[model samples]
Target chain A: MMGSLSGRYAIVGVGTSRFGKLQGVSTMGFTLEAAKQAIEDAGLSRDQVDGVLVMMPAIMGEQHGWAARVAAYLGVEPTFSATMDLGGATACGSVQTAMAAIDAGYCHTVLCCFATQNWPQGVAMQLFGSEFQVPYGDVGAICLMAHIKRRQQYDYGYPDELYGQIAVTWRQHAQLNPEAQMRKPMSLDDYMRSRWVAEPLRLFDCCPNTDGGGACIVTSAERARDLAKPVVRILGAGQSHSSEIIHPRGAEQRSLGGTKAATMAFGMAGLTPSDLDVAQIYDAFTPRVVHDLVAYGICASEEVPEFVTRGNLTFAGRLPSNTAGGLLSEGHLSGFGHIREGVRQIRGECGDRQVADAQVCLVTGYGGAPHEAPPTVSYSALILAR
Target chain B: MFAIEKPLPRANEDTAPYWAAAHKGELRLQRCDDCGHVRFPPSALCPRCLSQHHEWVKLSGRATVFSWIVVHQSQHPAFNGDTPYNVTIVELEEGPRMHTHIVDCPNDQIRIGMPVEVVFDRVNDEVTLPKFRPAKSK
Candidate 1:
């Protein structure tokens, strides 16, 4: 149902540092490492870098990001620069914009970067906490999902351990990922023992606040085809937003929106979920795995827990998902690591967990409304087939 | 006028009636004419059918404790005094859910499917945000 563009652009190089608390490291420094590594990996020099696109969550309440600071450090002021203002979501769009610029001849070599120090802001710091917390009840990140998780348990007769397996399995996947933040392996017993952040959502169900950076280089496919070693082509890229605010109260928000954004993104990819060899979805919470899958039509509505139990999401299974431990385990640098893992799965670098002959992969970006059922559900979908 | 006024979280055009009525101490929601579906975060258009037809209707002010969380801390500068608050998503009798705080009950005692009734707390003279309390009195 989807077709590819005829040689628009390709990713020539990719770079990333370990995802964790990078206290001693400045975001600029992290961004620089990824940039240099990407340039070197692309077999291109700093001089060859003509354009730069950066995605970093705002630090210190300041609206700007690391693009200009990075360009200054690289000593090669770029001809084009943009700081993705959206939280962690810019990672996906940053790469998409680079490919577009390279394709449109806006620049020859485009470097995309993202760096973050999310935990320092206090994992407790989130906009929804301010906008929605009404002097009591569920507040912070877990409040938004608690209703649904609890409802799934009661209304649908699901088990309490439903969440345990998800949190445990993903962290298990992270154990294999050297750069993953939560490296300690977890068991269902350990998961259940962990105190609840909100009812039904344990502390382990959340994504970690990590400091890290990842960069990818996009250039003309002509240059890509001539590159040394293996290069993963940017087969397709798509992005969308669901009005940056929650629908007004009494807006039929229950019809389950934010899914529309996924529809537009997957359409842009010209591919369906069935075509994906692996997917790195932005799972800030566990149910989000269910949300993204059903929204994208990868699985039937309400089929998430069953699918997980059947093991379709396993590394050895049909739909290898979150092999880089996902946001639940690997830590969230705004979904950049998800992209890095997407690139890896396509390159077949995942080792023991690698899907055999995996050709195409999908990665999503989530940034949207704070109080809605799925706050910040913005997404970017990519199709990569080697 | 000289004092910093506490902002009363009022619903605007999307939720103006709900807030407007809440000003008069009535809980309200907008019903969609197209899909016959009730919604929260009031909108002039139906999210399901995308039809620009809706009507403001007063609610039963009745709901169930479909799900909730006991907030251990408050991040908002406005809510620093509130700790261990219960942020609840009550499934209203009309069918959709509303994110509100549950007052007048011990935090530990919050149970799923518990019956709850609306309670309005006046932040000031103009706004009174809707919260809930245990329908059964202590």
Candidate 2:
């Protein structure tokens, strides 16, 4: 946790369901598994929960209906229920909301859940026209990044090998996580050689469509002291929105780093890049992590490929990032996996790959693409501390 | 000889030059007088310095196919007839990546960083789309 959010809220319990193609299981099944596990981890009954927050990118579900359904299934109707519909940008926002509610005495115990099953074809969420992309239904991030890469390569000579390095780094971390999706070790050779999906980005450079669920039970700091596990407090939070188009008005000024969101959260948490013990930057694409690291001022923009190439983000490196394998390796539940990793890092339960004494974590989420410039739509960031 | 069923990006103050350039078979970009940063899909203000002072410099018609997608489906009826068409996003060497179509290139040989050059295709009296072909052949 950053010093700013040092004592705001503590995460007493966290849980994740297996991430893969569960063709027969309903979304409710996955949600219940994660919720039950989280409640068990917290040693709390469903009856004790006072609030519920449903986390999702886009309008996958309407009106927090899914949260109410999950609560009903769990046999514990939370006194308060809300949904974080900020696209993939709400990963950290969802967690922060529950924390804020807990702090403000809106709810004593809050249960947050996110389950994503929509795959390959995507969901039915419409901020714009689904018909616009119907001709080529695959017009989301792949095209978004492809456009950016095309421009970057046209001028900067950004090599394809840079994308490979990002894949290899996250897979290296995933190899250590038993629950990760792409646990198999990936190499630069394999990455470069993989079948191309778009012009600049290969299949491996993009995250796979995986089905999964994640949940966490949040409680007051004082109540957390009585729990069996250590409490990870919420330190800071921030978020920002961009125009709907691919390149917004001032795109050249903004990279996909999502600086506005990250800074807002960091400032609120009273922390800087150096204060973090670990980072779980939002990564729907391999390039996203690189851009976010620079945009968040974790390092210089031009030095990103070099930094990643130096193994600084590897499991054993001095500066470890995406220790949970990220969306690339651990499976992207949109951004749910991002939040779960942050909680795990703060919990000190990440086993051999865990950053030693990781007390502060920076987690970010991204939604939409560069409408005017490079990155568009909503984003949020949070600093979690133990 | 067609109709656009979906909404086009409609010419705006920032994008009018690009459309006008395509109309003339000339690829033009805005170079910011403030910082000398050249960009494509023209804009009112410079992205690098936000300076409004600039000029519309026509491109040399020389660029590389930075990357491309062989779009298997066409979302717009304007493109429905051209199923399995290629959408090319090329690096202008001039510092802008313009989204266009690729012509006169075999799909099998369209590798990353493949050299290519720009060409203009007049769809109707009102629209002229910029496209690319193999640099060697052009």
**Model 1, B1-138: lDDT tens per residue?**
244223345345675677778778888777887677777667677766888888888888898876776654343555555655667767788876667777888878888888999888776786777889988642
In angstroms, the error of model 2 at A146 is 2.3
Model 2 Cα lDDT, one tens digit per residue, A1-386:
33434465777777877678766555677778888888888888778988888764342534347667777888876778876667677667777777767666788898878777653234453434321132222255666665556555554566888778888888988888888888887889999888756555678878877777888787877888888777877777777776422333344434553778777777777778889888887888876776678778888767766777788887666578888788899887767677677888888888888788888988888875443333356777877888
How does model 1 score by TM-score? Answer: 0.80
Interface RMSD of every candidate? 4.6, 6.2
User: For model 1 chain B, where is the 10-residue window of minimal lDDT?
Assistant: B1-10
A211, model 1: CA deviation in Å? 1.9
Which segments of candidate 1 are over 4 A away from where they belong? Answer: A1-7, A119-139, A151-157, A243-270, A371-376, B1-67, B72-83, B90-97, B105-116, B123-127, B134-138
Native-referenced DockQ of model 1: 0.27
Best by lDDT: 2
DockQ of predictions, in order shown: 0.27, 0.11
Q: Which candidate comes out best when scored by DockQ?
A: 1
